[model samples]
Target: MNAQFDIRSDSTQISFEASDNAQLSRLLDEIARNEALPAPAPENVFVGDGDYRAIGLEYLGHFVHIGGLKPTHRVLDIGCGIGRMAVPLTQFLDPKTGTYEGVDPVNEGIEWCVQNIASAHPNFRFCRLDVAHELYNPGGTMAGDQVALPFAGNSFDFIAMVSVATHLPAKEITAYAREVMRLLAPGGRLFLTAFLVDAEDLSRPTARPRFIKGEEDGTWIADPAAPLGAIGFDNGVVQDILKRSGLDIQRVSFGHWRGIGSTHYQDIIIAVKPE
Candidate 1:
């Protein structure tokens, strides 16, 4: 199948496109024949580490129990790679009351979800945006900072962007943060994961850390030329951005990226729009 679609722009300059997930469609049909057999291989599920399935399932639990996502809520999943969260969410979301909207600049991932998940669950929809990121969509036409989301204001009750901010520069991150805030309804919750630099790490200024914990500064860029190669922000900066985006920090679970005990490698933050 030719992997391309028509790109449309709206009054707000939001670009939109939806691909026919031909590859995933075939895979899903094949899996349906053998219900007991394990689903498609990990690579087919998503392009990530072997533990992606476990991580995805854990995220589902956190969103529902900790972030207060409910069956009746509308969800907007930014950077929805494949169907990691969407797969588990299929079992949790009420078909009649819940609706899921996932958008990603990577067409392949969105196509997969459109075929494997959206085909069976009409309430779930996948969209493609042309937001450019050096790591993910270098050839994309739209700049990440300038691309307004296709959705209207106050559209979602729950918004999740796992590991999305880690690859974005401060300007781009701020742009996306504000967009998330715009899409969220009053009292809506947001779950975001990113690499956070601590004051202690900044003070020490490790020439080279054991892991990718980042430099002594609160924000670290692995490659100055390629901002998205790997970026880390200080705790203060992260909080200030969230506050300016109209979100109040409900919980912040620092990650072990800095050698601290953590449930996930990347720091997890749960914030909510003011009621």
Candidate 2:
């Protein structure tokens, strides 16, 4: 568990590979430089300063431009890594009647977000949830951040997982589904993406693509029908979990189903809590 940084504690031990050593060092320096020197104040962390912020900013633009969110809509983003998505989205919220809540397991990510999220958006709220899971853990199971979040039932109008649940195995995914439903108000919508193969498809997959060879391998190449422990997924399995969680199927769109298998597929979906 030795990367380069001495980041470890009684409760947890996390480390990056030597490959990431330089990146981590650079991040520390960047924070120090920005913090000490202080630039002229746009203070818009997502766009104002760092390279990583652009990743978050692009997602924010898509959520509004593609996802069709109104500035006044209450938005809750799960697995909101850093302030990339959260920082900019916070700006769109009316902050008085509208609410924007973002959660992530990383302490530093949340700290950066808290310190930089605009003051203009008074209603913007972001919190660290140890119960948050790593976006992509081994076997594609989601890891819960170290702490549980505090929220009452049926509290949100809309919630999104983006690529969050895509990495979760069955149990965690089911657990998260229940939590999301519990937090969603009546008629609220949830947008999530996953690698499930559905019975709705009377036809099997048309093809399966080979794993990207060597260093070029990408997550988009994941084969959902691979195997039990493989990072892939299946619809039959997912549907059972959804039923147990009391969620009815709504709509699903498929992506990444190339290659040569009947089970290779990915989907972005929208679902609602039962009335």
My TM-score estimates for the predictions, one after another, are 0.78, 0.59
RMSD of each: 11.6, 15.1
lDDT of 1 by residue, 66-88 (tens): 67666677999998888777775
lDDT of 2 by residue, 1-275 (tens): 53242222223333323345354344333333343221223443322234554444444444443344444567788776555666445434444556878886656566666665634345767876666333322332234522234678888877877666555556666777778777877777776766554333324455333322112222222444432222335555555566576766666656555332322134556677788
Worst 10 residues of 1 by lDDT: 7-16
Off by over 4 Å in 2: 1-68, 118-120, 132-148, 197-230, 256-266
Model 2 / residue 101 / CA error / Å: 1.2
Model 1, CA-based lDDT: 0.71
> How many residue pairs of model 1 clash at the backbone?
1
